[model samples]
Target: MGLKLSGNKGQQSHRLVIFAAIIVLMTLLILYGSNNVNDAVYAPFHVATNYAIKATDLKKWSGKDGYVPFHGNKTMNLQCHNCALVTSSSHVLGTRAGKEIDSTECVIRMNDAPTLGYETDVGNKTSLRVIAHSSVFRVVRRPNEYLQRPDSNPVIIFWGPPNKIGKEAKGTLYRLIQRISMTYSNLSCFSITANKMRKFDSLFHRETGRDRQKSHSWLSTGWFTMVIAIEICDNIKVYGMVPPNHCGKSKPGSKKMPYHYYKPRGPEECVTYLQNEGGRRGNHHRFITEKQVFSRWAKQYNITFTHPNW
Candidate 1:
């Protein structure tokens, strides 16, 4: 009876050990599954950032003769003491602050957002134009129109998904940028790859409690441009960027502002995108969170926000 009892006790102990091992295996599986989900959500931005970094190295290209250096082979040169970040927002319209906006030695603009007609507000001078890879074709269609004044000959920085810059190098956008760069001595273009973008994203999240994974969105061109400005300039000033929901919370009878001042027809899709992302249930680009991050950075860096408070 004693021998039988001891044998049963040993069997029970073996079963308990097996059960614990199974539990640990299940826990590890759950953790790995959660991580995969997070990675999948952030993959696009990651791929894009990485591709951009790879493309930036001109030596990686077999046909190096096709592209010329912008600032004498330097990716970015911050010779200017101060810079201005000019965003396309309706708040700046009718403000007639063109002189102030243009006064800065380095003025940065976004995409195909124009300044010719609204020069009085947005300024005609552009030292740098930050464009997405998706919009490269649009610029190519009307180079003179989009490029604006030839005197400025802004250095273009094209950013996009990794696929767009990597294996798809033969695409029109890539070819166009190369052709234009080769044709125009003053015009030079650069690619901001995924690796650099990831660094900025990490920094933004670390500084602010907001996670891009939780937000389910990538950084906007404006925010990315701001990050570049912070790195290259001693002092930075932003115009026409307001906190999220500023228009909705304004006092009664206040003029409803459009997302872009240049879009006189109606509010652009970006406005809707921002609104959706700002909603409680939404999982899109966290424009508000990015704004908050910028506000925080402003306190730490030599940055200032003008026109529609930060």
Candidate 2:
């Protein structure tokens, strides 16, 4: 016997079916849709995080003029994880920190400082060199000693006024450096341009209220080296550097040290600094004043002075 359902019964059955379908849909959404939604929300965040990291890292080596080659147009960023700035001061004479300094990723030295004779005090690794215009003569005079390195040839950067090291300028020093580069193809020689030097002057003035030209204080090679190190190094440890108040801390009848580690019996380091600090500003290097600035910078940046740690 065929029977037709009443309208109320049919309606209740349809409602039950609809409720079951709704429950299935919700279940599927809970399992699958939530993950899809989370992925959609997280992709942008992942990309943004990487972008932030890259930006902060670039800030470490940006805005400053990079290490420029003397022969080519290609500029180098000169980045290092650990940098050891081995100064020319005599404070390193007895530190016995050569192994520790050489252990760093890069070892930076100033003009014509020989590591062979004093390897015990100054490490024999020269990953980079920053030389003054005046010291160009010493370097070229002993090309075999300073220019060529059997183990590794570190890049050399000669900083000077434009008239002395400029491309168009003519002088014995300029010609000699150019000739040296041509002869030692392995040697990577770089020069600081006129514009870069002026930028450095402006930096010094900004750090110290006095105008560099008006103050008549030439920026020391240590100043240049420290500035560049700040730009490129992730962490810097200055060896044999002294604090600004170091001179004041000296006691009467205290033992003395040479002006340079290489010159054992030369002028005393503290005595020279005191003389320059008080001398006519016409041609002096205000070493004490520069150290004061450097101390502030060390606190500001990733620099630390060792061999009398600051």
Candidate 3:
């Protein structure tokens, strides 16, 4: 027999292994202080948030000099779910009529249209308004069911898909934004169709709600872009939108951007809906990603939090 414990049974087995490791570190700090979630995580805090938003002046919301009028009546934050900048003034500018007018005349002559051209008199005064902003412009059925679109080109959903359906998005949102708009045609272009939100609420008087149930409504054909440098462009320059569920370093079988497509939804279908116990007096807490529920609703609606680094 080699004999073992003697010092009061080895100090009561080292005080019961320090009381079971302080009860497993207080149950992992009370489940990481009640279900961990502080991730603004834009790629590890985007270089200290782009140097604190380049010391806040943000180019006055540059479209270069003018053009800020795409207001489809109120409901700003452009497309909510945490809305960032260009918060409101509710984009309603116009001018872009030269022919193809039908979404009830692109919602009543979209401000008199002309910075790139098009208009058969959308109440033509001289034409050059520009500014549409997207959340999801409706209409789709094509497999030949006859609905297909991509004209009216206001940079329609950063142009993709077989070059507006000729053939090629098998993967990698086609070298991100169709090989850079086939070598840069003003960065990420626009112009999407399938209008109908009652002519986008009769071209901005506002009231077209019924898209139904929610998850990504508003007609969802798909599009997302925001380059606005920023100045006084009101409601915070829609903080140059980027958060549509980023992918970046491009992995997990690369080739993305059909609309920046993604998958991930495990862990028992990733639950949500606590709402209150979180938000803890607005210091913030409740989130299930969508860029931390739109960056805590863009800092609770003050808007302006653009941090996707480059």
Candidate 4:
């Protein structure tokens, strides 16, 4: 009887060891599955951001001409007028308040002046680097006609608003857009305004309606501009940009520096949405945050992000 009992006890011990082994294997399988699921979930966001940066690469778009294609093959054109040019210019000389006699230095343009043109050569054969008035520029076009990406033509960056505030600048912006449009029939124009931006908004007063100073006062139309640029371009080069003083303060006579250009009225309300999540749901307009995300995404997708500050 004692021998039989001992034999049974040994068998029970063997079964217990097998059961524990099964549990350990199951636990390991669960851990591996959970990790794979997490990776799968994050894969798309990584891919999208990577693809966006790759879309902005010049090498992928470069042709026989020295010109670089704007935004991969996708044209995400933004229009701006008198957005303000904080460029490097010789400082005005006056012997005042210092022993240093009239030393030349960089001077800031505090007022809205003439609009600088981005000259496009005839037949879309020639290329020129765009120089402008305000560091943060604006572009205007019909609703949804924000940018144009052509196969055979040079990519053009646009800046200027449609209103009479800066007519010549507006004209210059239109000229640039038309030049690109003339060459590329299917240029994608992405209008960045809060209110309706119909074609000929700048040419005809037909598109204007309500001012955004009242409702939804925390959104920056520029956010739309950036989104379009990021989404379209394979490689993006940002130059002459002012830190996000979105009230259009960079421009002359901009009262109260309206923080949100998308709202119905200016300074009517100070909402968190104005400062964060204005254009893209996940985007905040902080300079460092934008720079970091853009850089990482660009690098991952082999796109270069260049700032003119250097």
Candidate 5:
């Protein structure tokens, strides 16, 4: 109130204040960007490390009052050094590839996908089965003779909504899985923890910029199974999981490709699901985007694809 500054001097002071504020803002942004870069670099390793620790604890968790029921006999260790992930696709039936698929040290199958009638195409061996809660009832209750076969005793990893496994819930599928595991020592059942699922959900969103939670959709069984394989295997070979564009499309020879080789019928829903992923009429699953993620992973990890383009 006592002294007044010249107009130019006042203007210079204001400019200096603005400059200082800009410097502070730039510093904060630089720090934030650096943090994000670190996260981007280390996130996958963090998940892998967590998975490795959890896998080691799996043996301990097989005992009484543990999440996984104990195997009546010794636990069958998964040998995934050079594993083959056999997806439930019809393309796997082509070119007498079943023999090659069976040659892998470990062969992982999806859902209740059968290999009995289609043994010549899909191979007769199943080391592990990745099952979803929705399909549990069908796999356990179906009258298929293959479901009861002793050789079909694949270690089962089941995943689903948290409510399905809650103590008070009366879900038949959950109860059936429990009953089957209790009765059959050969068929061990392990539920993927809710925390692990959420971690995977976050990782998918961070990697792909797509959030399944926002769409109220869950990760496909194939995607989850692949993650498990990556954790355990040094070499991973994928069969029958074609890129989305190849589905329901014709080849250069004018021969049309079916969505699934097992179900050669027209208008396969899987093809339609892939086609409509990001269209005006969209689907819950972002299959094409998932394929893109897999392609990137294939390049980074020891992963290869067979039967149609990856």
Candidate 6:
């Protein structure tokens, strides 16, 4: 089934039928298939987020340059039938979608959103985490929470402007992250090269028909996550990203949720989002504009949205 069996009774029955059909297909394949066999793919295996890397692949990045480990070693192997890209938006609150998000083959989270206290809403399992360079400090601030992943190996990809991530440049965040990777041997970290960053800028230009540099628009972390998802996964389900007009809709006196579920009092989600949309800051992320692009992507590819279901 494209989605999980968390709907009404009739929907459950329909999903049961689909389940039975899939079983039959698998059974027949096992009985009569050739020596070469392939993994069964569900309908949602279209796009995925979060690059899943393991500590075992760290000989120092030798292959692909898109995502080389913190040691600069290897490109992570991505295999997922369905992926869930969980956001930090407060819209995820009270949804109780933890079970559904965990049901996917891979769960990818952004930055350092914790699942410890909010396990009822956000799942505990994480296959990969895509991080923003500016948010690196937050993850390292609490080593006990983020880096000490004994139960699972989650790959982390850090993205930012070239000057900020370059070795010779003044990007102390990347240097700090490199130190953290060495300190925590169990953690596997990856970094997108400057070339890849330019490619993403090209992609943005292609999609929006505007030069990113001229626009003075800094790409959002969500944007990077989406690009990574499209490259690796066959399907993707995005959570907590509000639609483009969600803030503009005339819903009188609606409670404005916080920008991030983890930060309840920091900044209201829609207000900051509106500022991003208006391009108020010199290098601000175009949150609403990014959603518009995401909407187009959902139509063009196997992408879906939840938590206010776009």
Taken over the whole model, the C-alpha lDDT of each candidate is 0.67, 0.77, 0.27, 0.31, 0.66, 0.76
Q: Rank the candidates by lDDT, best first.
A: 2, 6, 1, 5, 4, 3
TM-score head-to-head 3 vs 4, winner = 4
lDDT of 4 by residue, 6-86 (tens): 999999999999999999999999999998986764231111222222233323322222222322244333322112112
Tell me the tens digit of each residue's lDDT in model 1 across 65-144: 22223234644443457988888777788778899988888998888788878989888888888887766777777767
Candidate 5 vs candidate 6: the lDDT winner is 6
TM-score for each model: 0.69, 0.77, 0.23, 0.27, 0.69, 0.76
Least lDDT summed over 10 consecutive residues: which range in candidate 4? 118-127
Q: RMSD per prediction, one decimal? A: 12.1, 22.9, 17.7, 18.4, 11.8, 22.5
Report the lDDT tens digits of candidate 2 across residue range 122-166.
888888889999999888888777887777767788898879987
Best-matching candidate per lDDT: 2
Per-residue lDDT of model 3, residues 1-310, tens digit only: 2255477778899999999999999999987866544543211211122222112222322222222111122111122222122211111122222222222211211211221222222212211112233211211111111111123222223221233312232244333333434443322323322232233222111112212222122211111122221121234323122443343334575432221111122121112112311232322211222233334434433445432321
Residue lDDT tens for model 5, 140-180: 66635334557667677777775685334537656776777
Which model, 1 or 4, shows the larger TM-score?
Answer: 1
Give me the overall lDDT of model 1.
Answer: 0.67
Query: What is the lDDT for 158 in model 3?
Result: 24
Measured by TM-score, how close is model 2 to the native structure? Answer: 0.77
Better of 1 and 6 by lDDT: 6
